[model samples]
Target chain A: MATPVMDKAQATATADYITATFRIRRFNPEESDAVIWEDFQITIDPKERVLDALHKIKWDTDGTLTFRRSCAHGICGSDAMRINGRNRLACKTLIKDINPDKPITVEPIKGLTVLKDLVVDMEPFFQAFRDVMPFLVTEGNEPTRERLQSAEDRERFDDTTKCILCAACTSSCPVFWNDGQYFGPAAIVNAHRFIFDSRDEAGEQRLEILNDKDGVWRCRTTFNCTDACPRGIEVTKAIQEVKRALITRRF
Target chain B: MSTDTSGAIDGVTLYDVDNPAPVIEPPRKRTKKTPKGGGTNFEMIAWLFMRLSGIVLVVLVIGHLLIQLVLDGGVSKIGFAFVAGRWASPWWQTWDLVMLWLAMLHGANGLRTVINDYAERDNTRFWLKMLLYTATVFTILLGTLVIFTFDPNIS
Candidate 1:
């Protein structure tokens, strides 16, 4: 059996801080046309989140470091960046979860124009969302009380309702990265949310929109969107469901 | 202190209200050619066809591989005589013909999707698909003809 001294020392070592290097892709149009990689070495606890490290860099090291983040606990869907070549929310990823022994690489999400260091032009992503008519549609007179639905009907689209409009899934899609015209996985996932709702009467219209050449058909079912979604939504399955709905509508 | 009213900091021109950058349209935005809320369901049908034909091709292709490569004498048994014997039967002729058609169409549709995904330019996509369709048609027709017009006795 080991002595108590070793146990106390082990506990102290467990709480000890280690130095981590963050390699971030920085692009400032005012500074230069080329994107530059800057490394920041910080002494941090392993249990600290990546977002905390970023804040430390911005606050302590460089005041010009820019990144979009809100509701730092993964609710706002912001702060989604390419962490180690994979799309992940900085707030949700811990420093030690990823191999911090090597320099951690961070960049803006792909398939969108990088406006600054980590911010991307999101107008295109939102435009696709609007084109799908994501809101519920009803033609009849408003019910005096409320629109009632069965438990099963509500459960049908429950999986897709969790979308926070984060561009993580859309940016990770290879098809979208190659061709921006393709309505990405996030747009299809949003359409799935409305198309399957039993109360929504605009399923046919949404189906028609998705049946276009650049809509749900563009999805090759690569499952990258599913893997990139920070909210844990099965985005590829939702796209497949929309494709199925389109087919069954015809038959 | 001199104020920089020219919207240029040092030497680079600042893109501000005074010197605005050219507007860039959002990708895939609707236009005159893009009709709203109405389009054909050809892609949906094509997608469904791929799935259905894929299931059928698994049986057809595996059965074909087994017969041609793994049965009785394996590859050694396969020659002009074996092909002639198989083609002599109407059932075998029909089987080969269906397999040819399904495999070609399935492969063509899959390539069409690949071309659509990778080829960014319009003319490139059109020409590539045209080439694909031309090849697909020629192969399908030649295969059908060979299966139908095959003669058992050839000099």
Candidate 2:
């Protein structure tokens, strides 16, 4: 049980600063039939995020390195993209956290049309969101005061309220990719929010809406949407809850 | 942004570029009752069937292989006599009968899921599932009949 001797590690001042390569998928509909990867070499700070590196590349090296972001923090959900083979918020994923040894792969989320380097046409995703009737629906006159709900009732559908409509969960779905008609996970999550809400009178109406051919039945529960969600929502469980609600006629 | 003049969207009046929020639409009403007998819970049952049958199949299939491939000289000991001897016992007969039915149904339903996921056209999906169901039924009937009417004394 003798103590093992440790070798002296090399001392380098630039240890915190590593040279990272970014491989980005580029496509323009009129230009090419397929996508091509463009690589950019950058020296990045360990604490900096992948979004910051993207901004650096776009700002310094290439002006055309296009992507979307609003509140550089994770709240806006505008910066959702594929980073290193997984869907996540670019602003939330640290460059060093993803292993800086190899080239980091950044691309637009799948199951959507890429308008440029990393920006996708979110019209279809939004349309799916819209089709689910995401807003609260009431049958009668508006209440004078706020519609009161119990703490337990509020907790029922609270998990689904984390949806920022990032489209990360929807685009990462195989069913959405194979058959775009399916309402996808985001729509179902939104429906679950209202379907379980105690104050919402139109729960049955929303449930009836979700009872379409492309509605709750189409979700195969592949867990892709659950895995891809940046919000850490239990997407598959919500879908199953909605399904049980459809059968039991109660939430 | 300019009204999507193509009318690709059904209910939206037009696209507003200035306020690009997605236009929310009402959910479509259920056009017809969920067919006649097989009510709305048919898909739910099918999903449940897959999981339940999968768990049972793992036991039945692994036990089947263990006896047929690993017990007392394995496949070499298997022949018409071995099968006839095993079928002689009512327990084995029931075990095999249940296994045949469950396997055929489970495999058929799994392929049905695959076809639903991949088949692009309605006709393609329907016809493919029809072919699968036909094969599964034929195999189940033939296997069940053989298991029941097996003659132990035949040459």
Candidate 3:
């Protein structure tokens, strides 16, 4: 005998009432036990974000559960973690979009030291950013008046300014994961911003710094970084432009 | 102030000598082998290609240079007729076709590897690869069409 299908109204109501199980990977250095993954079941609206579910779990069920969140709007660049085997912001991902009946695997981003359950030490990742000297430098006395720039000049490097300092691109890179010194995609993307800027006179110096063995030359162009960026920055194109610039000596 | 010479004992000049410290050991050289990233196998294949393509490119490029520049009395000999004459022969046609296919594929693959390593957004990667593959397909198709469809004596 065939079972009768539920009507659209009934289906919607059932989905709303269903409780989903989330299997999250947890680790704490202080615990000293082997990495143990625990499951947390929460009754939530399908529209709720994974972050919300996590908060509910933290607030009601397990105070020991830990994760990091700030600017819960995804602008702070915090809350990046591995969900369903891909790097994404927990705040941006909806539980409905993932497998809800089965346990969803959640863990911290790979290729960084795990500071706690879901928080990884972001210092090393930021250190690479600092080394890239993500700043604008100009020679001669500061202009008493505003320095003028053409509209075209501004548009040239406009896309690079969208980076949110999220480690998504860097963590997705196999090369960066293996060799910490590789400037990684995020740093190179920032370098490309100034290297191509018409007003910048430091292009050559930056290119020389990046042309070393650990610099842009290390990029194999795997395109993984591109797939991981939430900001939709064209990191590969920027890197290629940098490579061309280095080869041709044209900033 | 009175300058007094020390009693002229054995005439000796005191000197402080600084010898160059033994040449500081050079920083350890990075191994030539590609770093053992997650994809050692893939890297090995890529390294092999750089060498192999470099070799084939040398031959194909040299022969191309010679035929275009040196053979048949240099640049003036090149015209529609020159290309027709070369392609009329099976051997030359095969050579040109192989060169065309190999060079284009090699360059495209190398570039694809580069794109994957850097593009940071999912949609961006998809669209860029689409563009790359499209261009490669177009060029290969056009080249193949020209190679086989050459008409030496068009009306």
Candidate 4:
């Protein structure tokens, strides 16, 4: 229902609108005693991503600005940060998603060690995955051919394989932040991938592991993790199935 | 030409490969503990709910036990007539209804928390939550139906 003239006028209006500021949280281990916030003003197109704005700021204004980014297209799972008190991928978030008139606050995700400006240490996150033994385990000698799986069997565990290890789900989790030993959402999801897989032989052992007090039992679903996930993974549901599995001793 | 001559000849031996030493590197030590995020005021309300529900559960459970096991000369008194008599009173009906609703909600919320903490994949999370919510709704509806539509006597 829109005409070309109206679209052109709208584009012009968007381009002319210039007052935008980003309030970024900065922490320097060597110089400052505490984390401090600094604001940067830049004129940008409305269609540009928040990542682009950050890049402009780092390029033209402050050379000391630091952040991790790779595969700027959302797949690599890097550049996960807290924007306006929400965990999101910077490259995927457009400026329009946030209030341009207000000072947009950017910070690192909580419950992780901040190595620098926006980068947090992901060692602990990966360590939790390791604790869950997130790999397929087969009973005997290696198969000479591809392991045969039916369509229904493959579909059963299909939903759990889309995790990109962005840590959005894990960091949004209250239990992970509260108790470090709680194996977190991502780890459990990974475990579910193998546990539910038809090719895996370690389902019982993995179930026993997850049945520990601090394992699957610690989840108190707040749905925050589900909301914060950029990949739109359903984190809470997998945990429920795990709970059911523990209770009924069946998938 | 004897063993003593051979030992003397080995004085200038360049290499000895008898023992293989174990290579040990210090374990990778984590520098600092991960920091916990800020707690919002919402946590306080959740804590309060747990305490209140726990207290209510104690009362409901005790009353349930007493009525079902000890009152009116024990289990033999718990036939259709006894149930009908209890349901005839508004207070007893309300009590059972309240217990049913509260316990179901409490258990569901607790389980919901467990799910959020563990499920990782987006689709998995979605489907699993769907299943949980479905089961919870079904149970609640069935329970309410039974409570309100019980027939005292069937000819």
Candidate 5:
């Protein structure tokens, strides 16, 4: 790993800069029917994220090179892409984290149509997210005050609330690659967030929606989502919990 | 995706062409707790059964191999008399019977997952699974018969 950039002096140390090659897959819908991998060499701080290298390419070498990014930090979830054949956020993966010597291969996340270089058609991803009703539902009138919640109640579904809807976990899945109809992992993670919420009254409806063949049943217990999640959500365990809830009829 | 207007031999024509409007069907919703016709989706049960059977098989298969291939004087001590002797006891008969059934079902279920994952064509998948079920049933039935109907007095 690159020496952790602790203080200012180490952060910009000239000696820490190294030359790395970025081999990026380029696709132009307007131009060619085929895609091509273009390579560019650049010198960068080893501690910098892969997004920094893409910025350099876009600014200096090829202005036509395209990608998506807003918050350079990891929280935005806008920069999720395939780096070195794995789904990861471009902003979180450092140059040193993924073999700085070997040409860093950057491509869009799989199982989605590439609208541009790194921009995938996120309609399906968002569609699945919307179908899960990633919101709290209650049958009764609104609570008079800020709805009272104990710490224990808050902790039940806490782990699943970290989902950023990045689609990294979903697109990395082999099952999703095979069948797009399957509600991918991010949708399930979002569902698990609300389903286990002690205050949510509509948990049963969400569970019923997931009980369909293309729903939670298609998961197949693959741990790829757990591995691919940049937010460190226990995706597979959450899926199993949903399955158990379905089998036992207990939300 | 017959979204393009072209003959089999002709190249696809871009949007300057006429094609049928795409069909958009919402995802098929399921209301039944079980699959339609009030039967369980046996595949889900089979998946759960795989793990349970796997644990049992590890014990049954290893213990069987130890007694037959290692514990006695090896394979040399096993012959027709050894076979007849083991089947004479009801316990050994039941052990072999359980082993036979579990191994057959477990292997068949595992192959079913493989077929679901790899078989691309609908007809090919159906026929291949039929063949697998046929062989599995044949072997299981024959093995069950041999275990229960052994003469033991045969030369």
Candidate 6:
């Protein structure tokens, strides 16, 4: 279940409105060659999300302000952007959670080309995801019955399975920001999801794919990915697990 | 206004048929020619070597430091005679040899990863690694030779 925008205790109390300044990095190809910072002042309830603040700015202040957000709750992962110098789902970041007294800086996630104000070219990120062969890869004919797995076996990769592909974890990575060839943390985390699955037969192939120069070895264990994951996935730990698997040649 | 406003911000003139921005390839987009997976476990082995050698290096380095700097009159006793006495034994020679090899390889691999991470261009990365390897090999070989061929009685 989605977490309520405002808890019952807060909802019961008198709503407090505060003026929040959103300093958004604006970019439009038609306007100018250089990117510009555009700040919008909006009075909103502290319990409302950064997404709501953005919506208020777009509707009431300026229609030209561009950003990508869907499912104004956090599930869609489309709203992952750099808020206050950290990757977060705008929908998940509450105005009061971040210091409302200061201006909240919202920019596009790093390591990807910005197509517009806040929309980046997601093709490269998706390509890395595709290269890992994210789906199950069992060989031979399909069985009449479902492939059974114990609950204990299922728990091995449960943390990584929470990934929404928000590009927050991948883009927040320092290595990804510099070396584009290095498969970022998200791809490795996704690979881990299937590699540890009890029923998956292609763990070896996936390990081989990740064993390249641009694979798990590039991770410096900065833990930026773990911090950036809106789903709270332990990204660095999953990467280290993949590295250990490669070393031992075991799942 | 003239039909061609060279660098102006006019809408239609900036992107006409004759004048258009160069289209660049997206970052890290794998092409047909891009090699898929490295068919070898070279990187995996290197990574494993780092951890294993790192553990060994801790013991070797701390022992060396303790003997040379902390034990038996500290830094004052670390003279030519003290060195000669240590090298006279094959055990000390082997210990120094192993320490030299492990520490050099561990450090070289660490630097290599650093270069690979920071150096953006292919030529820059390749040349930086080349320099690192050359220096590492020279130092390791020189240290090994010194350990094996030290004539303690030459003094």
| Leading candidate by DockQ | 6
lDDT tens string, model 4, A74-149? 9988988999999899999988879888998999887777767888888878877776778888888888999999
Q: Compute DockQ for each candidate against the true complex.
A: 0.21, 0.07, 0.02, 0.02, 0.11, 0.33
Off by over 4 Å in 3: A1-17, B1-155
TM-score of 1: 0.88
Interface residue Cα RMSD of candidate 5 after superposition: 7.9
lDDT at residue A171 of model 4 (Cα atoms): 81
> How many angstroms is residue A23 displaced in model 5 relative to the true structure, after the best TM-score fit?
0.8
Candidate 6 residue runs with Cα over 4 Å from true position: A1-15, B1-33, B153-155
Q: Per-prediction count of colliding residue pairs?
A: 0, 0, 16, 8, 0, 0
Residue B103 miss distance in model 2 (angstroms): 1.0
lDDT of 2 by residue, A72-115 (tens): 89888999999989999999999878997898999998777667
lDDT of 3 by residue, A1-251 (tens): 99878797686875665598988887654443235678998899878899998998999999878888899888888988888888888999899999788888888887776656788767667766766667887899888897789999989999888888878888888877655657788888998888878878788777766765567767878898888887888988888888778656631
Task: Compute the interface RMSD for each candidate structure.
Answer: 5.8, 11.3, 20.3, 18.5, 7.9, 4.0
Q: What tens-digit string does per-residue lDDT give for candidate 5 at B54-99?
A: 9999999999999999995987899889999999999999999999
Which residue pairs clash in candidate 2?
Answer: none
Q: How many Å off is the CA of A168 in candidate 1?
A: 1.0
3 versus 6: better TM-score goes to: 6
Candidate 5 structure quality by residue, lDDT tens digits, A183-246: 7899898999999998888898888777765677778787999999999999999999988887
TM-score of 2: 0.78
Candidate 1 stretches greater than 4 Å from native: A1-15, B1-38
Whole-model lDDT per candidate? 0.87, 0.81, 0.75, 0.75, 0.81, 0.86
lDDT of 6 by residue, A96-173 (tens): 999999999999999888877888888778888989999998889999999999999999999999999999998999
For the candidates in turn, chain A alone yields TM-scores of 0.94, 0.91, 0.89, 0.91, 0.94, 0.93
lDDT of 3 by residue, B1-155 (tens): 13323222254322212421122111211232323234123433454466588789889989999989998799988988788888899898888888888788788777775665556565876888889999999998999898899888888
How much is the lDDT of residue A209 in candidate 4? 69
Candidates 1 and 5, the one with greater TM-score: 1
For candidate 1 chain A, the 10 contiguous residues with the lowest summed lDDT are A27-36
The better candidate by lDDT, 3 or 6, is 6
